[model samples]
Target: MTSSAFTESSLTGIPVKRGKVRDVYDFGDRLLFVATDRISAFDWILAPGIPDKGRVLTQISRFWFERFTTISNHLLSMDPADLPLPADTDLEALRGRCMVVRKTEVVPFECVVRGYLSGSGWKDYQATGAVCGIDLPAGLKQSDQLPEPLFTPATKAESGHDENVSFEVMSQAIGQELADSLREKSVQIYQQGSEYARERGIILADTKFEFGLLDGTPILIDEVLTPDSSRFWPAETYQPGGAQPSLDKQFVRDWLETTDWDKNSTPPVLPDQIVEKTREKYFEAYKMLTGEECTW
Candidate 1:
């Protein structure tokens, strides 16, 4: 469907926090997560977001949260009809993109699990034969599958890149026991999720997870295996030598690279073609992973 982007939302009297692509509204013990069409690249939220982007991301996360019941997630419900929304609130706009979740003390670290050498992991391996201080085999190509998945922890920054840190550093910051537990849980979830994707002809190259404590136990929080949080490569076209075809925002990034918009300044507005193509990628990912057409 042709439509304008829902870059942000307003609900009277409710405090909201805008992240890179999601708007979080605090409702005392509950938090409303609205994944908007906003897209970010090189640390800037670009203009004129691709419509339906938010729905794809939110529904993808919902699929994962529902599919993997073994892993505890913070999702209370995807429907917010029962919420005390303001009289002027746009429930139709929020449809298929809102997540109502329980509030928790979010963990400070990002639990990243890498099953393939790519992205920042590939760079680290090229430099040190390691990722997050965990050593890997030598002579591995850019997108080569690792002998085993590695749990690399990163410090979650408010803005900019999340700094990848060693597991020892993570342990020191959040105690050895908790860090170890989080790592194990992250690896386990990645293994399960990746296997499921592989069966559907998609490779879950790597994914990052965010966790929060509830009753002294860490439970999955934030987006799970959505394209925004994971690197998904088409298995049939996978090549270890370099970057493989992806079903994510790589289209947007590739287009941005061709432009001269200095990242120091405001990012350029995406062209109509670029916006539509990027939206298609998000929809394809949601469909391939969920086994259902994105009728929304």
Candidate 2:
């Protein structure tokens, strides 16, 4: 692993749009997704990102995208050498961190599926006994497993947090037919992933998926089933009464809660130990999920 974190990429002759943790370069017919080592929590970008984080996320997504053969997605290539680039582009540095995907008109919603209550789902349940308008059984704990997975959609925000919305609201905005189709696809993928993770001694408690339209056909887009987009908890240590230990960046969010810094402004940099431990967590998750060493 490199001692430095790569939070940005330089590509001379192309337009790039940066999100919380990725640098997206428009490649005309296709888009280049460069997962940077940037980390964000509670809508605030944190400093001193976990090293190899982009690689971990990209590889994990690649593993899932390749594993689910029936699902159509935007991923075209993971090798940076496959794409034409500017003269100053860093191929070696971009190796595992980059992906070339077919560009499509993205659906403006975060398709979330949850088999277990947690995060904003838990908060909403505590307040209204439902999540995205799906009522749950009474007396459910923070991390309690639900009766079945629910497709809870959210508004896709460019910045800040994505707001949870009822399926009816999403259907009204995007039309009933498309909304239902995306919900089915989202829940189906979640079930497939959750079952697989369980067999591997991990619990995919919940996850968010983004889809896009290609020739009027819905296809999965953006990152799929990565630590940044999913809550992966070790099965052996899971207890549903409260927040569980996770293999993703949730620990960093946990650590941030201990600080006096208000989450409104810029957050504090993670300590060296925190950074090291977080890196280990990402590495461990990748190793367990793929059963292969993350050479990147």
Candidate 3:
């Protein structure tokens, strides 16, 4: 995503925070969250971005925010017409990818729930036969479904990848009551998300969620079920014997894997076609899951 599409000068709200893809401006008791098209991988922001990536992610989050409202409290106030946007703001230009949400103090932990063996969980399992201190059955391979959904909490690292910790560690960091609530809520959200995606012919292998508290109540915050935050596998191509074809950034990761460049070193610039195809995949996931056109 080009920086030209979003300028700090154009945003007029109380400054709250900024992250890799979003610039959040506080609006009194609410927030204006802007999604940018910037792409990050291996914990590094690349030189180029896939156009419309932000919109796709935003649209996906909007869809889930609507779909999941019955399950939990989420930070979404999607009514553009009623929002207190700047007078000259291009509301239409930001369509499909922005939200005006309630400003809530974020919970200390990032609630991550994994249903399959992959990524860092897989790496940790391969090393210790356990994930977040939960032991798994022997001889399990990559992409294997767990006996039950696992609650893997991780420290919200400032930069680079977040580090996974056991449930005990989570309770130690946060209070026992909040920790218990986070784990239960995380699993419930994942189960609902996975089941919903399954009906759409996609496998929700895993996903990460962030939660914030409004008073004593927990509310979901940040992005939800976007390609940037979840792993999607096409149901038809999913096989337990091999690496499943993913619908997220697997294409980008695979391209990087074949290169000689170390992930820590300068990341090789993504090619034009790869960027285009990746962008399409993000849109495809949003479309198939929501059954709605990505209009931004």
Candidate 4:
């Protein structure tokens, strides 16, 4: 099946706010968030959506939510299965991924925790000798493991890119105690997630997580460990020298890089083959990491 094969229908009576990928509908004190098959890379939404991409993301999120809820608070209900759903709640259509979570006021910051040197962290370190605010050991190369994981937080931008803020800047913004707590929690969550993925033959090379305040306490909200919000590299092809072939959307990213399309401009529509390959990649990642069949 192709992206053209799955167009989203508006939820009955429920208003929605669509993001780059997910469509979020208000549900009183909670929210019903649905991940679509749309795929985005390099901050651009590419053409030819990945079939089952949304279901894969949702299943992964649900897995992590079940695994780590005891470690910290998350936006979950006791009976997630009974939440209000669409008329076509057929397991295949709704999948096992769609989430009906308690909505909280989203924090204005993105709590990024890194166990390795790569991505934006590498770029920032190469230029400024630091990542976010934490200074790093000299002579660190791309994909080099950090001595210890670090918490690098960034301010969530409204329109453009999110600016990486230092720990000091973060402290001043949200108070020292809360800042410290957020950083600690972020590192702990990353540690658990990274270990879990590693055992499943995937290197979760640093991912970002979001937290929100519910009744004055922080709870993990939004998607966690999805390809859209992460850098997933297959363990078999993993190499430390250069850019790794990722199970995420590197296929799309690579194609975009070979084109004349500027990153700042509108991205070109993806070819059918590229979209199909990307969809298979997402499905494979979900299966390998979770050890579960992509039923949807």
Candidate 4 residue pairs in clash (backbone atoms < 3 Å): none
Question: Higher-TM-score candidate among 1 and 2?
Answer: 2
Candidate 3 structure quality by residue, lDDT tens digits, 140-238 = 999998899998887886667887777898898778998898888889889999999999999988888999888877888889987889999998888
For all candidates in order, the CA lDDT equals 0.89, 0.90, 0.79, 0.77
Best by TM-score: 2
Q: What is the lDDT of candidate 3?
A: 0.79
- Model 2 root mean square deviation, Cα atoms: 1.0
Q: Where's the lowest-lDDT run of ten residues in candidate 4?
A: 1-10
Model 3 C-alpha RMSD to native: 2.5
In terms of lDDT, which candidate is stronger, 2 or 4?
A: 2
Task: Name the better of 1 and 4 by TM-score.
Answer: 1
Q: Please write out the lDDT profile of model 2 over residues 155-246, one tens digit for every residue.
A: 99888999988899999998999999999999999999898888988999999999999998999988888888999999999997988999
Off by over 4 Å in 4: 2-9, 73-92
Q: Tell me which residue pairs clash in candidate 2.
A: none
Residues 243-293, candidate 1, lDDT per residue (tens digit)? 888888766887899999878987888888888888888888888888899
Ranking by lDDT: 2, 1, 3, 4
What are the RMSDs of all candidates, in order?
1.2, 1.0, 2.5, 2.5
lDDT, candidate 4, 43-105, per-residue tens: 666676777788788888877888886445454643334667666554455555468788887
Q: Tell me the deviation in Å of residue 36 in model 2.
A: 0.4
Better of 1 and 4 by lDDT: 1
The TM-score, computed over Cα atoms with residue i paired to residue i, of candidate 1 is 0.97
Report the poorest 10 consecutive residues by lDDT, candidate 2: 1-10
